[model samples]
Structures are given as C-alpha cells and as structure tokens.
Target: MAIEKKTIRLLILEDSQNEAERLVSLFRNAGQATRVHRLTGIDDLNEALQHSWDLLICAPSSEALDPTEAIAAIRRQAKDIPAIQLLANNDSDDITAALSLGAQDALPQGEDERLVLVAKRELANLEERRGRRASEVALREAEKRCQLLLESSVDAITYVHDGMHIYANRAYLELFAYEDADELEGMPMIDLIGASDQASFKDFLKNYQGHDGHAELQCNGVKANGHSFAAQMSFSPATYDGEPCTQVVIRAHSGNAELEEKLREISSQDLVTGLFNRNHFLGLMDAAAERAVNAGQPATLAYIRADHYASLLAEVGLAGIDILLTDLANLLRSHFPGEAQLARFGDDVFTVLLPGLSPEDCREQLGSLLKKVESNLFDVNGRTVQSTLSIGVAGLNEKTAKAQEVVNRAHRCADELSEGNGLKLFDPADELAAAANRGSIVAMIQQALENNSFHLMFQPIISLRGDNFEHYEALLRLHNPQGEEITPLELFTAAKGAGLAEKIDRWVILNSIKLLADHRSKGHETRLFVHLSSASLQDQTLLPWLSVALKAARLPSDSLVFQFSEPDAIAYLKQAKAITQGLNELHCKTALTQFGCALNPFNTLKHLHLDFIKIDSSFSQDLGNPENQEALKTLLTSLHSQAKLTIVPFVESASVLATLWQAGVNYIQGYYLQGPSQSMDYDFASGED
Candidate 1:
C-alpha cells in the first residue's frame, strides 16, 4: 500500500520574505509539501497562532520578531505547535537559552540540508505528540466506561491486588452485606470467605498465575451478618487504574429457585411496566408453542400497537409514556387470564399469548379491551389524553410451525390495518410473502456490509447564530443488489433483527471519521455528527475503537459528535449515559436527536450532560400552526435556559425559518437548506448573522 502525502501548515516567524521562501523551498526539495505563512512581528505571529499549524520555524536573529517573544505568544495562546529556532551563529549559550524558552530544538542557520532534516524530524515529533494525546484520551474513556460497567454489573465483581480489595461493584457490596463500597475497599479478600475455605483459597491464590485467565472455584461465602452461603467464584487477570489486578466474580449459590427466577425476570423484563421484553417474550412464545403442540391445544397471539403513539409520546414525555404503558399492561392483565403472557414488544407495540383462546374469542376480547383503552381519559400531568390500539390476532394450528412466524404475521396484520382501531387476523399467504421480503432485506444488508457497498451522505447543520465552525451530520445509505436504494429505516430494521446493528454503527463511525479527516485536510475546520445505535451505546469497546480510529485519521476528538435518538437513549438509559459521559470525557460532544417528542423530555436532559439537542421533526412539521410555534418557542426557551444548544431539523420551508429564528434555535437542518449530499459543500458562512 502506498502512503498518501500529507500537507503541513508551517508558520514562519521570519522578517525576511526571501528567507521564508528559501525555508519553504528547502522543505519542498526534501519531498515535503508545505503551506507556509510568514509572520513579520508579534501581531502577525499572534494572528497566525489562532489557527492550526503543523510546525513553527523561527528566525531568532530577525530584527522585527524575537524568538523568545514569539514562543511566549504561542504559549499564551495554548497552542501545541512544535517550534524550531534558527540561530544565525552556532553558539552553545544561545541554543540553551532558546531550548529553555520552549523551543523544541535550535538549528544553526545557512545549512539547508540540515534544516530540512531537523524540520522533518520536528514535524514527526509533533505528529507523535498528537497521537499520544489521542491515545491518552481514548485510554481515559475506556477506563471510565469499564468502571461504569463494573458498577452496574449484576454479578458480584471485585478487583483484588495483593490480597486486598481495591474496588468492588454494587453487587459485590450487597453480596458481602456491606452498606457501601468504601467499607469493602482496602479490606482483605479472605474476610468474605468462611474459615474452612480460607486455607484452600489462599493456596489457590498462591498457585494461581492467571495463566488460564478464567477459572471457577466453589467456596463458602460469609456475609457481614455472619450468615454463610455457598458460592461459585470465578477469577480472571485484569488491569484496573493502570495496575495489574485480579477480577473476582462471585455468583452466590443460594439454592433458591425463586431467587434465580427473580433475577432472570429482572434481566429479561421491563422495569417500569413489568412486562416481558422482546427477547423474553419471544422465548416465552416459543415455549408456549411447544406446550400447545404437546397438548394438542389451540393458542392465539395478539399484537397490540398504539395508534398515533408519536403524538401521544410528545404529549406525555417519557415519564408519561411509562405511566401509559404501565396502565396499558394493567388493563391487559385484568382483561386476560392470569396465565396469559403479555409483553412490551417494540416501541409502541405490545404482545399477548393466550394459550387456549379461539380466533373469535381473541378478537372479541381484544376489541373490547381496545374500546376501553380508547374511551378512558388518561390523566397526564393534569391533562386528559386518550389513546387507541390496533390489534392483530394470529391463531396457532397445525400449519403454524414457528413461533416467530405467528408473531411476525400478527405484527404485519396490525401494521396493515386500514382502520387503526380495528383488528385483523393473520393470513398464511401474507406470512410467507413477509418472510421472503425480510429474508431479501437481510441478504441485502449482509451483502452491503461484506461488499463495502454502503454510501455515506452528509447534511449540513448550519448555524443559525453565524458560528464560524462548520458542522455536518453523516447519513448512511444502503442499496440492494439491483442498485435500488434501501431506506435506512428498512436497512436498520433488518440489521437489528440480524444482530448486526453494532457492526453497522462501527462502519458509519469509521467512514465518517475518514471523510471528516479528508475534508479537514483541504483547510476546512469541519465537524461531523455521527449517529450511534443502541448496540453501540451498550458496547463497552466502542469508545476504545473510536479513539483508535480518530487517531488513525489524525482527527481531533472535538471534530466528531456522536448522536443518539431520544427514544433509543431512553430505552437504554444506563448505557446511553455511560457512553455519553465517556464521550464527553474524551473531549467529544454528544447530541440527543429526535428530542422534545417524549412527554417531559427535559427529564432526560437532567440525567444526561449533552452538548446539543435536535428537536423532533414533528415540531418542525407543525411550525405553521400558531400553537405549535408557541410550543416550539417554549421548548427552545427551556433548552436555552438549561444552556443547551438547540438544533431543529426537517426545515422544509422558508416560512418555518422565521419561526425558528424567532425561537432562537442555535442550528437548523433540512431539505430546505440542502438534502444529504455526497459532498460537504455547504456555504455556512453565507448564512452567518
């Protein structure tokens, strides 16, 4: 592979234009491309220091520019450009003085070949310093993310160094009956083990080199209250806080099936609504299907979708949505048998499996339930809100071979309902066609990934306040084998089903970084906003991977802002918070997109320290309405009061711009400005205030 040549921006603190040209020629003659700016005095040097530069070459003997004064100016600006001082005479005292004054090196003048070599070496050193800084930032981000994971893990985890406990997660503290981690810190690891096991544990520790990395041992655990429990302890060698340590994971063998079952429920169930999650629900469906087959019984699945859920969510906020879902779950529980399986499926969908309900009975029951939900006035923060449901019923029979097929058919029927409030029964023909379509989409996604056929487009996030910095949001596009574009919604749905969302997120991040780096190389100070999926939010390795990619591209961390949708961030709040905090720690900004849709969306802002909030497009869509304008104004005011930069997207008309400007939005993006294009060619300066 051939290495691409890089252009270095050089600031020359030389009074003589001729000598500056001579220096530039020397670099060029040595096969180095340079953009040279000559600074004749302190003012010129100060102005030049405002922008980024690869290296600074100072002529110490210049009458107008003093090398020491120039170096001090650069220091005052906090610029990190490597500076080399050219001495007219090769004097030890002068070289020492220059070196002490923050000059990286001093070179004797009149030696062109030596000048080129020293300049090149200094530039290389500058690049190395930048790389190291990026690595340090990445390391800190990784460590922070790891700490978060450890703290949140359900398994009792502890880091031991020299037989002393250095760190312990919440589960570990609870396991040992300690009230706080502070109580366990610096405590002896053996204190938590029974006296009978202490001797064997010590022997095991003495002989353990962690060469195998992971090993489990059965031991007796003693709690703070002197109660002992059987425990299985797994040990692995790990690094924490830059030191070698042993990671101990303790799984208590309480021998209580109920406790194990409860733990499983906590992991697989939704906390707020207490409904089975998508995965857990599907698992239950599979088991129910198997039992139905064994008993030769009939089973029917109902897929319930909330009508106009986006509008409801906007009205209620996340807290209100939670209350709505909980109420809905309770309603389902009351209407159905106790043994009926209910789950919170997708964002606005719910699923119920009735093991013995016939198609007619299932439809009647669900229809009545829908009527009750539609008639009920939900009190959301003193406001009465009504919601309706779309029901799809799929009855299991000899032909229903797979649980997923039934579930998918029910979902499809619910989605295709002409009247949102009515119910539809699944058709076998529709199921077969839908399955084929899904398979085709999955194949397209796989081929796109393997063949590197995905396309990236950038939409300019123009500053309403006339900020000089350029910003663009990176958008991804996928195509089928036939060359027709596949919408992101379709592609992502397929990717998520195939468990490839993380891979897609990684691809976008890497490509966006490469594009941003290339754009920056052309003398533009541009920033790219990249979207991250929920998989990336939970992925502890993403930060480290991103750091390496940024360093490889030689891009500053600040030049990339990672964005997460408000719904996704809420769905995976813990992981989102951790990832955002990690990104901020790495000096990268984060934006919550599709914001202001959730009822009480500000609640999320209180928990997350974000740099930007992209208002949901619904707000923009309703801008023409006076009431919506007021709402937008109010939302923008609240966001600005909290010191958040606001970005309003989907600005399709000039009429909306006036309202947005009046609302004091910090940034705006939509087709009206420019749709996502193959190039970042927006004239941001033209729209400056």
Candidate 2:
C-alpha cells in the first residue's frame, strides 16, 4: 500500500490571473496536490497570511503587486511561507535582488521545470520549519506544567547556582520561614546554615562539586525568626531555566527512625506493583556501584522486559495490564528477597539488583525465574494472558565507573532478544570487538595524509631540574568528517593495518619541524618530541628523508626528539637500534617512551643508547602504591646511572611533584603542566625561577 502525502498549500501573487492558474497547474502536473490562493493586493496577502501556507510565488513588478510587497507582507505577518520570484528575464542582477528581498529563489520566466523543482524544495523546508515551531510550543507548555508541579510540591525544594539560590518553591520558602519566594531569591544558601555548621557545609559543598549522584548532610538550619532547627539537606544535580544547578531538598530531622523509614518506603514504592519506583531504584544502583568500585564488591543488575507488551496490552486493557504487572512483581519479589532490590523501572520493564552476587550466580537465579514466568499463567481480570520475558544481566565490579552504565548495558542485552523469552549477559569483549573494526578511521587518516589536513597538538614537558629549556611533545590528531576527534591509539592502529603508519609519521615530523622553525624564529628555543610508529622504525629510508626535510626547514636537528614506544622498540629491536644510531648521526635527539614494560627493561636500553627515557605511565599511575613508588625510583636511578635523562610522563597533579623531585627525575609532562594545544605558549622562564 502506497502512503498518501499531505497537500502543498501555496499562495501566489501575480499581476496576471492566468499566470497564477498556470502555476497551480504546473504543480498538479508534477504529481503534487497543491491547494493555492491568489493574492491580488496587500489586503489579500494580509488575509491569506492568517491561514497556513507552504510556498509563495510572486511575479515581477508591474505596479500592481510585485515580489517585494508580497514577501514583505508574508514577513510582517511572521508566517513560515517560502516565497519564489519569477523574473521577466534571466538577468543576474534581478535574480540577486529578488533573493535579497527574501525570496527563496528567483527563476526566469518560461522555466516551468525549474520553477516546479524549486517549489518542491521550498514546500519541504516550510513543512520542517512548521514542525519545529510546533515542537518548541509543546516544550514550553511542558515546562509550564513542570513549574506548576514544582510550586505545589510538598517537598521543600530550591535550586542553587554557585551557592546562591536562584529558585525556591513554596514549601522551601515556608521551611525557611520566608513569606514569599522573592524574599529567598538571590540569597546565599550558606546563610541559612547555623554559624557552627557553615564551615562543614562549605567543605561538603566543595566535595560535591562536579560529582553525580546525591548526598545528604545533617545540619542545623537558621530560620528567619532567629531559631535553629535540625535539617537534613539532600543535594542532586538538576537544571533550572536551561542552566545546570544543584537542587537541594531540606527535610526536618526526626528522631523516630522507624517512622522516617516508613515514610521513605511509601514515597519510593510504585502504586501499581508495590515495587520500588524508577528514581528510588536508581538511587540503589548508585549505592551498589559505589560499593563495587570502592570496596571491590561484586554485583549484578538484570533488566527484565515483558515480551510482546503491545499485544498483551491490546489483549487485556490498561487495568488488566496493571494486574499482570502486579503479579509479575510479586513473582520477582519472591525470587529476589533480601539484599536484592526490585523496581518497576519502566512501563513494561522490571529491574533486579543482586548485590554480593557473581555474574554466574545471578545468571543461574535469573534462569530459574525465566522458567517460572514462562510456565505460569497471568490472570488478568478473569482473562488469562501468558507472556514471556527478555532479560539482560550486567555485572558490576571494581571496573564499573557508574550505575547508569550498568543499567544501560543490561537493557541493551535484553533488547537483543529477537524471539523474546531469553536471558543474555553483557560482555565487555563485544564492545572491544566492535571498536576494533575502524574502516572510517583508516579512511579519515588516508584523507588527512593525502590532503595534509591533520592537526598537530603540543603539550609542554616542564623540567624539574631547573633547566629553562622549553620542551613540547608533538601529538597528532585526526578528526572524522563529522568533526569528532579520533584517538591516537585508534588512529595509528587503523593506519598501520592499512599500511599508512610510516606516511603518518613522516607527515607529523615535517609539520612539527615547520611549526618549530616558525616558533624558534620568534626567539623561543623550543624542542618537540615527535612520535614514530613501529613501521617507521623499520623504514631505513626515513632517516635520510628526515635529514633533507630538516635542512630545508632551516631547523636545527637537535630541536626535534624522535620518540618511539618501548613495545615497538622491543618488537623491532634491531631496527630500533639502527634508527637510534641514524638519528644520532643526524644530530637529532632520541627518546624511548612508555619504557620499563619489558621482561628485561634494561636489555633494550643496552642496544639503543637514547637521550631521554620516558618511564611507563603505569609507574606514575600506581605511585600511590608504595611498592610501585619504589619501583619507579629504582628505574629512574638505573636510568640516571646510564647517563639517560629520565622523564616521567603522566604527572597529573601537584601532589606528585615532591616525589618526582626527590626521585631526581629530569622532566615531567601531563595535563597538570599543560594539555595539547596548537600553541607553544608555556612559560618556561617563570616556572624555572
């Protein structure tokens, strides 16, 4: 069956009535059902603008109604109507003027095919603009309703931005003894805290910044009457008036712990199924994630969706579906009792959180529930409706970053069920396998190498030994057609598979040298650490080519440090040794990066006498571990003994400075000093002083 499209509404303003009729006929002949109205004068256009319109066509000026007056009339009425002008002849100036006067396009007379094609495009664009306007209106209405709900809510709520209250609900105002919201507006939230609690509140606020999830603090709140009362404030991330802010809900502290628990339970329960609501279930997930990531505990989340929900809803109405959900919730409650949180996550999906359970154990338990649900018949208002489930299980461990990720993974697993009534576990390997196929990345790199469109980013490597020399690590970046940056790891890996690694290396070297030469011309003595791939290490032709390029750029060879990773050097040790010797012959410095990962780290250094040895980032990341710190110190000592200027990468904070300085490391680099940018503007003189 072919679907029918809506009629295109057009408004035409022409000096001759015959031309308007012909225009309508042309549209009809082009297979478009158009309902058009003819405008004779300004009054006619004003009246026509009151109704919906798609496209407007106007004829050349004849002292009656020209294209200018017709388009101006449409604009004055603020109508989303696209206007096209018909010129007497194909004069370029006339077409340009018509377009400048707000016409979508100006077609010369007698071009019926071109006019029809342009009209179709204008009609499509008009429909899209109208749809967007409708959506904006609907969004405004929804925001209004939400504002009304917030004002009438019993919970005391206030939105705070940078510690000042931007908005407060009626309950929030009353809780603080303010007569009106205006009295509380623009007031510092810390002023509401008692003098003794302000310091602790400030500390809590500092820790809560940029963190998700919710936090609660028990403190004393000062009322307008100069009385202090115990208040429990809950903070969560929220947005107000399209600006990100923190939402604080304050409740009076009650000593009746049991009663408080009962109130919390009532608020968190769903009316239809008596299970935990979506918001409360998400809160439990957050707590579970905190335990898993911080305490090394294991947990599992299951997203169970009732299969064929639309068909089931059709079979048993809304009331019957409620009954079915209640029955299913009860069955789920029986299976997951203690320490297991069950929630009505959505209309047809139920979530189960199994804490302290391995993925294997959770799968076994869910498998039994799947069988029970399949065998049992759900009685919906005396009508039996048997349905199955699609369950997705995701494990949460020390590797889990947040709770939402687990929920999303679990939901994705459930959605993978083609025939319904099955269980699947989320596997990290699947994501890795998908990411490994990067044809788009290879294409982007190839295009960049061909067009010389790759961008070079520089991060300053500051010296800790009081050396004032400016050093930057040259990084390569490739943005896809969509302008999204592809990471260096993914970019190079793809380029290598496509045999473009050596080309990319040469491109970086040439560009970096050019940039360095220009920068040095400005009287800044700067050096760049340019990286090379494994393919470049084996390419014996690279050294000779690099010499000619450096000489052409009039840049000193010592200004560039050609760096290759330890893994690459280990894989091609003989090539790396030869490359190191060749770079030395060219008077260019050499650095072996990501060092100390091999079984015999010093053995590779024995063959390749390098200028700089950048220790592996693992040593820096694990500095908190005492053994790792000792390992780094030991590695640095051995390198220093070999006259190798040791540099520790990933110096992410000032806290690691004292350790690195005491360890006698020569230089440091990471975001703490500077991130990769297009400019080499780091102040080496000030830092050295």
Candidate 3:
C-alpha cells in the first residue's frame, strides 16, 4: 500500500507535439527508468493525476492542452500534484525567464543535463505531494467505512459528478426517498434536503471543499412519504467521471412513524419506572446537557432513586421493572410539559432536564412533586408495594457553572440524600458559602476539640401554666475569635449539607450528655435532648457510637431525647422507626420536633409508636388562628390517646402565649421563652419569660 518515491510518475503537458514527444523520450532516457506521462490539455492532465501521478509537467499548448490551464486543472483535481510548466529556447535570459513562468525545464526544448536535473528535482516534489494526498484519501476512506458499519446511520451515500448520479447506495436512495439511482441524477444534491436544511447543507459543502469541516453533522432530509428524519451526514469531495464533485454519505436515525421506527426503545424502557438502562440513561443525561447548552439554557439535572425499588425489582424482574418504568415515564411526561427532556437514567434514578428554570423555582417544585410520588403505593405484578424516594436536584448555578460540574454535584447529593430513598438537594453554596470559608469551617470544628468552640446552652421548655421549666433543650453554638458566637442555626444546618453532620451531631450528643451530667452534679437536674440529621441514620456506626457517648456522660438513656423533623422522619421512615424503637427499648425518648408537615401522613402516627410528637410551627403558629388552633387541638388530642404528645407552640409575643393557653398546647419552646443565651454573657434578646 505504501508507494515508493522511486515509483512516482508525472503528467507532462506541452503545446509543441515534437517537444512533448522529445520530453517523454528524455524521461525514458533516465538510467533509473522513471515513468513520465505526456498529456496535451488540462482535462487529460488532471485525469492522469487521479491514478497516482506524482508530478504534472506542463508545456505551452494551442488548445485545451495549454500548459497554464493544465497547471490549474491539476491543482483542482489533485491539489498536492507538483507541477512544472515548460517554455521555449533559452534566448539569453528571456528563454530561462519564460521557463520560470511555468516550466521546470528550459534550454531550447532540447533534452540536456539542465533539463534532466530539473525533471528529477520536480519529480521529487511530486513524491511529497503524492504522500500528502494519499494521507487525506486514506482518512476519508476510513471515515466512509465507519459510516457503512453504523447500525444507526443517518447519512445517504452517493458517487456522482456534474449533476449525474453514477452510483447510489441503498441508504442513499432510501434516505432521500429516491425510487432509483437514476431518479437522483440531473438533480442538485440540495434537492434531497428540506428547503431550510438545503442552504445549511450547501454551506457545509462549500466549507468542506476548502477545509476539513465535514465531520459528523445533523440536518433534515425529505423522505419519499413526505416525512423526514434528522439526517446526520459527512462528505468528502472526491472523483467521479474524472471531474470535480463531492461524494456525500448520510444516515437516517429513525423514521417519523412510531411503528416503523428503527429502534424499539420501549422494550429497553423500564415501564413501571420510565428510566433507561444504567449505561443508557447516564449517556442520555450527558447528551441532554449538551443540547441544553446549544439551546442557551441552564440545565437542571435530577437523580431520583426509589428507596425500595430493589425489593420491587427482585419481586418482579424484567417484566415488573418494565411496567414500573413505563408508568413512571408516562407520569413524568404528564407532570412536565412542553418537551421536557427525560432520560430513564437507571433502575431507581430517572434523570430529567427542566432547562431555563431557576434553581430556586425548580427546588420548590421538586420538593412538592416528589412528595406526591411518595404518598402512595404502586401496583407491581399484582402486588401493591410502597416505596419512598430520595431525589437530589442539581442545576447550573453560579458556583456550579458547567454541565459536568452541576451533574457531579447533583449525583453526589443524591448519594448523600439516598436515605433508603430520602431526597437530598445539594447546594454548592453550603461549603464555600459567603458566611464561612471551607478551610475555616473544617478547621473550626477540628480546633473546637481544644479551644472549646463547642458549647451548649439550654432553652427552658416552659409548661403551659408557666409554673416551671419542664426541661431544657440543649442547643449548640460556636464562638469565633471575634467574640460573635455563631448559633447552631448558622453552622449546624450548613454542616449537615456538607456531610459533616455525623461528626457535628456526635460531638453535640457527647457534649450535651456531659453538660447535663455536670448540671445534675451541681444539683441542677435537667433532661438532655440532642438533634440528629437525616444523614446520621445512614451512618452505620451511629447507634454503637451513641451508646458509647451515652455511657461516658453517665446519663440515663431515658433522660436523653432524640429530636428529629417529621419530613426527615417520614423520609427514612423505616430507618427512623427502627432507631426510635431501639431507643424506646433502651428507655430513651424520641420526639418529632416539626410534626404535622404539609405532606407527611398523620396516619404515620398510628404506625410509629412514639414518646412525644411536637406539632409543626405551621399548625401551632398564632395558636388561636382558629383553624390552626383547632387543627392542633384535634391532632394533639388524637396523639394524647396514643402517646404523650407535646404541642410545642412557638410563641414570640404575649398574644401568642395567651392563644396557646386557650388552644391548650402542652409545652412552649421558642425565642419568647428566652433567646439562645450566650454562655459568656446572658445578654439574650429583651424578653420576659
């Protein structure tokens, strides 16, 4: 396949028939026996270059065989052909100057030493051109072969020139809907494409002639049935009928008709769920992001993993998963309107893009939407099964600027949030936030071990009658060197978002137990309560870790209350229930801190045996908002029969306290009791308890 430099040939064009004949004889006169082709015109010269002529030696001619025209023609047919035009007798300097114009040889058209040397030198240049052209041709042929092997090609292939179709492949006729190869002849190549795509196709063609721009590209091509599929094509300007033209190759991905489609995507689709294969869906998400950027929009990526999909999948394998995906996909399509791109990412994770929507708006909607999805049981293989979901949403925000950056964040958040299907929305702002730098936050927690930035303050849980404090809830704070103490509100929430919840929660628990014991040792008895993040349950070591922390503080299990929110409780309901039940066995108490969430099942109360349920602020706000008061009273009374329920009315004013007394909430815990008092100085907010 590799042609040697010695085997190179040259096309010679000359106006002087005798001189051209003599030039051919001189080339043959070479002791090396090199090949020299004698042509009279540009057409004949160009035609000879296609089959490996290394050089084009042109001489003055009368008609189409003129050497000047021959050089241009050779350049067009094969731009890499080394060409040298010949001139007449060397008349002092005029003859040599004439040779300088186009000829590589001079000397009165006689075969001599100078002519032989010139011929040999030009042939060497021709070899270099041949190597360059061969490389380009090989690359084109390889790409064409790849096109032929594509199971899902969209390009049509044709070998023709001068508005005539010399040959058309099956894909070529079928893609353009031409009845036969002859049908495509005498027609412009643009006619196969739609009016809109024609101009773009032509522009692509024009660019291809000058540059290597004809790679993979998509356009629309008309079909015989008057329908069309997006055609992805590539072109290479090559030879046909010894003339200048481009050989185009194209493929049609799928047809417009659903039944006649190339890929049976529905089979690959998980019916009950509507996610694609693990491999397929991730690729789809990446592709969707690419499309989103092209369309000038901020792409939102979400990974939804069902907590109990494995049990469902195991119970009913392929058949069941299919029904699940199909149903889920249909539901998603219905909920999201106007061409929302959906990719069934994996078994439990179905990715989607709501492009152009702000992260805040999307977060609120996904928060509500996922709740609806988790509120019911899905029917699978004649068995009704329930599963909660942990959905993580990530989007192109200020910090998460790129598509992959946002996607990786979203996936990582999903992993953090997947508390047996519990949803986690990861914020890039959590770590590198405006209030705290990442280095300092981590360093502060580490340094807290020695300097005691970790300290607990108790907010008195006053009784309804205001007779005495029922107990004190342990709250945490961090004191920076500036003397401004940061409350748990500042760092705790942010830490939980950054996967530091386990360490912080454990630290708080140990410190709280120690503080409670110390207070009791000073003859001040107070029950200790520590808050836990949803992330903590996923930590396999949390229970054993808690047991050790409890023993070290010499605190009775019953004196410790583990506080958790209703949404968090419901999200990892199975795990939450198990932990709560275990705590009960150890005689420890558990309270739902923010109970009665908008979407949580009050029915969950009947299922979970609890020590206490703190009605959410929404239901206890303004205690006598009548609707709220009555709702709280009914919920409390219902719980009173089942368990000891504490209706903690968060009041900040006298009116709220009076309303709570009338509403009959059992306990009050809020700023109205006393602000989170500083340990160094009890310069709390101006309030009377």
Q: Best candidate per TM-score, number?
A: 2
Candidate-wise lDDT, in order: 0.83, 0.85, 0.63
Which candidate leads the pack in lDDT? 2
Give the range where candidate 2 is weakest over 10 consecutive residues by summed lDDT: 430-439
Please provide, for model 1 over 372-441, each residue's C-alpha lDDT reduced to its tens digit, 9 standing for 90 to 100. Answer: 9988888766778888889998887655678997887888889898669888987655644444456577
The C-alpha TM-scores of every prediction are 0.39, 0.42, 0.36
**Residue clash pairs of candidate 2:** none
Model 3 ranges with Cα > 4 A deviation: 1-452, 465-470, 479-490, 678-689
Selected candidate, larger lDDT, 1 vs 2: 2
How many residue pairs clash in each candidate at the backbone level?
4, 0, 39
Deviation from truth (RMSD, Å), model 3? 35.4
lDDT tens digits by residue: candidate 3, 1-689:
01222444656665566556556544432313357666755556556666876666655345656555665565555365665544464465755654555544444444343555665676666666667789889978876775465424444577646445666776677766677767766766666678888777677665666654346567887876788778767666675544666666776655565664525576555544544555565565566566655655566777766667777788778787777667666667777757566776765677777767755667776776577677766787787766666777776533343466666667777777635545566664443332344335544555564445677777766566443223667777776646566655446544653456678788788777776677667655456567777777556677777787778777778778888766566556687877887778777888877775423347566556677677766665655467777887777777666756475746677777776666566777777666555331222222234
Query: Model 1, poorest ten-residue lDDT window?
Result: 1-10
lDDT of 2 at 437: 41
Error of 1 at 599 (Å): 73
